[model samples]
Target: MFCASVEQMKSIDRRAITQYGIPGVVLMENAGRGVVTVIEKSFAVGRGAEVLVVCGVGNNGGDGMVVCRHLLRRGASPRCFLVGKKSRMKGDAKTNLHILEKCGIDVVEIEDRIPRQFTRSLGRSVLVVDALFGTGFRGKLKGCALEVVERINRSRLPVVSIDCPSGLNVDTGCVDGSCVEATATVTMCVPKVGLVFYPGRRWVGELWVVDIGVPEQAIAEEGMLTSLLESHDIHMPPRDPAGHKTTFGWVAIVAGSSGLTGAGAMASLACLRCGAGMATLCLPESLNAALEAKLTEVMTYPLPETDAKTLSLNALELMAPVLKKADVVAVGPGLSTHPETEQLVRSLIEKVDLPMVVDADGLNALSGKLRILRRRKAATILTPHPGEMARLTKMGVPEIMANKPGVATRFAGENRVTTVLKGAPTIIASPKGEVLINSTGSSALATAGSGDVLTGVIAGLLAQGLSSTDAAATGVFLHGLAGDIMAERRTEYGVIATDLLESIPEAIELVLGSERGFFEGGVRRVL
Candidate 1:
């Protein structure tokens, strides 16, 4: 699903109105009707249930007026409260306001201050519809608007916001002050960039995107760069019944050290769990025994080690022949930052022609010289948490976290490699300017060794012949889905990296089986 910024939304709206000849008022009518449909589905509106719709003077208010009309038709009494003066409402909004008055619905106009009666009305109503601001709104909510938002929030009434929450920046997902917390936001056209992001996402609650007659050609012409990753977007090739172990693909995981052997083991294990034909863990010879004991199915390559037990430069020569036989390589989980280890990582990255997924210490190894990533001939995917990304860009973690999509896009475009900026909503950016925001996963994934598992999952997908972009996008989605399953089985607080690994196969099955359902002899089964 495409995610549109405020500008792109505006452009699409304009194109729909002018080029496609779809009237603005028609779009508003469709939006209001769609919202009412959602409302009807969620709550029982007729039989004396009262609804309060608080609206501003813009087109968003027009939508609310239409909602009031629809509610009246359905045997529900809806009271419309205009935050601004009725005279200020113009264009399609004015037309709707006149219609509301013609229909004999109560239209209370509150201009300067919110009347005490408005607060009382909120208490009596079963639901509140917030149409005080649209996607064009920015900055803080002050004066009567502020009081109105706070009063509605304190009332503990369920709110359905139009377009977006009243005070959110539709693009950045930032709120200056006093934003409405809605039970659900009925967004028109495409999902706004802010609704899927944090801070704004919290206020948005459950989001429903309503089609308002916007032409698909109009949206395509806007050339949107960001997309929301869905399960249907992932494409997995059919397995050949005649194929052997090597037919699936081999993944080489170069990771681990003396104390952090678990990282390498978990990564290699995750790779195999995600359907890699074979997984080879190339670690310092000293740590190989421990990993081999833990990982029964994976093969271990004992590489030369330094005094600190991290892989040494001599290990690169040893890895050359192994990498030649592998489809993809996963590096940098728990390989400590010894000078020799960093050198080995740099040399291997520069010399290796195979696709690679670099994470954790591998990212740390390239901290000062991220430019080297640009020189590589093959595809490289960097899976970095905010901290690792900060180091690579020489920016602060706060800055990186604030604008993850922007930062990830810039780095990926510059380095000519796929970048997976891992977080709550992991973002995957391609060198070709496409960005995918992963919608799965939760706080349960905030455990140690989680990222190591993600590195392996992406490597496994890459080994299966997925393009770098598809591999990163699909891997992140599956990793998050597995974490979500683990959270359901075990509470979020108790979930560990191994829980995610164990649920990998189940996650894949869930995605593949999503379309399957029980059917009767000739018709679809109802139960």
Candidate 2:
């Protein structure tokens, strides 16, 4: 699903109105009707339902006015509260407000504080429509708007925010102050970046996008590069019916040290579970015996080890034959930060020509040596959490987290490698600056060795002829979906990394079987 920033949405709106000759008021009516559609379908609002419509003196409030008109037509009573001066409303909003006034509806205008009847209004209302702000909203809610949002949140009523939740910064997902916690958000056209990222996502309980008379050409003309990865976007490589073990893919993984041998075992096993035909786990000589016993189906190769029992710099030459025959290579999982091992990782990154999935210490090895990414001829995928990204970019965690898409896009564009910025919602960026926001997983994925499993999944897909971007996006989505399934069966706290390895096939099956997509219906529900 295509997603837009606030400015991009504004441009699309302009193109629809000016270029396509779509009337502004007609778009407002479409938006308001879309909100009603969600309310009727999702909330089951029927006749005689008392709804509260809180609106600001802007185009957003104009939408609320239109909603009031529609609700009245549907035999529901809607009390409209104007949070700003009525004189400030202009354009299509002013026209809608005027139409509501002509219908003998009393629009309560509030400038500063909540009136005495505000509590009584809340007591009688079943649903609250927050049309006080749209995607253009920035900073924090102040004065009466702040109080109104706080009261609406405390009421525990299901809220349907128009366009976006009031007080949300659409550009950054950050909420600086009082923001409405809506039960659902009915966004116009495409989703805003804020609705898909961070704390803002928490405020948006359920997200639904509605077409507000915006033409497809208008949207396509914007040339948006960012997209929300939905179920229908996932495409698995076709399985050959008569294929053998060697026909699928051969993944070579170099991981593990003395005490972290489980990392290598988990990564290699995850590769096979993700449908890789075969896998050979190469670890330090001392750790090979342990992994061989633990991983039954996976093959193991013993590489040269340092004093600390991690893959040593001397192992670089030894991996030549192993890598030469492998379709893809996964490095870093439990490879320790011993100076020799780090050196080995750098050398492999610079010398290896095969597609690579780098994670954990492998990413750590590139902290100050990111220029090596530009020297590689083959595809490279880097999976880094915020802290790891901080180290790789030489930026603070807060800085990277503040603007994940921008940071990931910039890095991928400059380094010419696919970058996966892992977090609550993983962001996958292509070398050409396209960004895909993964919309799966829960806190269940916050377990040890989880990233190792992720590395294996991506490498497994890459070996099967998936592009670096597709492999990262699909891998992150499936990995998160696996985590979600595990969370359902074992609870979020009980799910571990090994549990995810077992759930990969289940996630793939679910995605392949899902029929959900952008159907003919005007509204599309997005999680």
Candidate 3:
């Protein structure tokens, strides 16, 4: 599903109303009705269920009014509270306020503060509908609006936010002050970027995108660059039944050192586990025996090593035949930043003709030499956590974290390489400027050697003929799914990176499962 920014969404909404002739009120009604549908199905809202609909003076408030009317029609008791001045309401919002009053549903206006009676009402309410803000909302929650949002949160009721959780910066997901921590957000038209990005994503529990009658052409014409990766987007290429080892794909892994041999082993093993036909661990000549003993199914090639036992600059010449035979190269995991080794990495990055997945030390080698990326002819994927990203771009961690999608997108576009910005929700950006936000994984993935496993996954997928973007996106989703599965089995605290390896196949199967369903046309559940 396409993830739109505030301006793009506004433009899409405008084009839908003006070009496609969709009435604004009809769209508001659809949005409100969609929220009601979610409340009914997700929360089991039924007759006599007391729902507190906290509305503002904007169209968001109008959406809340529609919710109240729908709840009343369903025999549910809904108390509507307007957080701003009723007179300030305009257009569809003003029309909805008058409609609510005519239907005998009293609209309590709170101009200064939330009365003590509102607190008592909160105790009686089964759910709180947060229509006090929308995607256009920015800055902090202040005045009576902040009070109402605080009380709703303190009430501990299942709150459903309309469009966005009040106080959220829909573009950046940064909350300046207090923001409503919703149980679910029923975003209209398309999922917003902030809803998928961090800090803002934390507040949005289950995300359900609802179609508010926006034209498909309007969205397409908008040319949204970012999209939330859905299960359907992961297409595992079919295996040739008669294909042998080399036919599947061969991953030549140039990684490992004396102490960090596990990184290379994990990368090579993950390649095989993720269905790569072969994975050759090309490492320091001295450490080959130990790695050979550890990785039973993986092949080991001893290469010339520096005094520190890291890949020496001499290995670059030896890699010619390895690159000649391999389908893809997985570089950087645990490869120490020894002077000669770093030089070797930079050399291979500039000279290698095969597609590569660069991670850990490999990214470090390119820190001051990123210009080399622009010269590469084949596809290159850089999987960097925020710290690595900061070093590569010479930006602070906070700045990069502030806008992961934007940072990743810019880096990929500038260097013409696929970038996987690894974080809570990984952002995959391609050289073509397309971005994919991964939807799987949990805190359980915060483990050592996890990224090494990811490097292998992507390299394996690339070897299997997946495009750079597809490989990175698919690998990330599957890697996170594996972490999720382990988290479910052993809790987040107990799972490690190696644990994710065993679950990769299961994760792949789960995503490829037949039980998946779409919410509606042009509207899909993104969480």
- Inter-residue clash pairs, candidate 2: none
- lDDT by residue (1-527, candidate 2, tens digit) is 89999999999999999999999999999999988888888886779989999999999999999999989999998999999889999999999999999987789988867986677888899999999988888777898999999999999999999988999988887899789998999999999998999888989889999988798889999999999999889878779999988788999998999889989899998888888999999899988777888989999999899989999898989888888889999999999999999999999999988999999999999989988999999999999999999999989999998899999999999999999999978999999989999989999999999999999999998888898998999999999999999999999999999999889999999999987576335787888
Give the better candidate number (1 or 3) by TM-score.
Answer: 3
Alpha carbon lDDT at 39, candidate 1: 86
Q: Estimate candidate 2's alpha-carbon lDDT, on a 0 to 1 scale.
A: 0.91
Looking at candidate 1, the ten consecutive residues that score lowest on lDDT are 518-527
| lDDT value, candidate 1, whole model | 0.88
Evaluate model 2: give its TM-score.
Answer: 0.97
Against the hidden reference, what TM-scores do the models get?
A: 0.96, 0.97, 0.97
Q: For all candidates, what are the clash counts?
A: 0, 0, 0
Give the alpha carbon lDDT tens digit for every residue of 1-527 in model 1: 78999888888998999999999999988888878887887666666788999999999999999999988888787888988789898999999999999999878988788887687788889999999999999889988888889998899989999989899998889999889999989888778888888878889977777778787788889999899887777766557899888988899999999899989989998888888899999999988777778889999999999999999999999887789899999999999999999999998888899999999999999998877899998999999999999889999998997899999999999999999999868999999999999988989999999999999999998898889999999899999999999999898999999998889998898788665332221112110
Per-residue lDDT of 362-405 in model 3, one digit per residue for the tens?
Answer: 99999989999999999999999999999999999999998898
Per-residue error (Å), model 3, residue 442: 1.2
In candidate 2, how many Å is residue 489 off? Answer: 1.8
Clashing pairs in 1: none
RMSD each, Å:
3.7, 1.4, 1.5
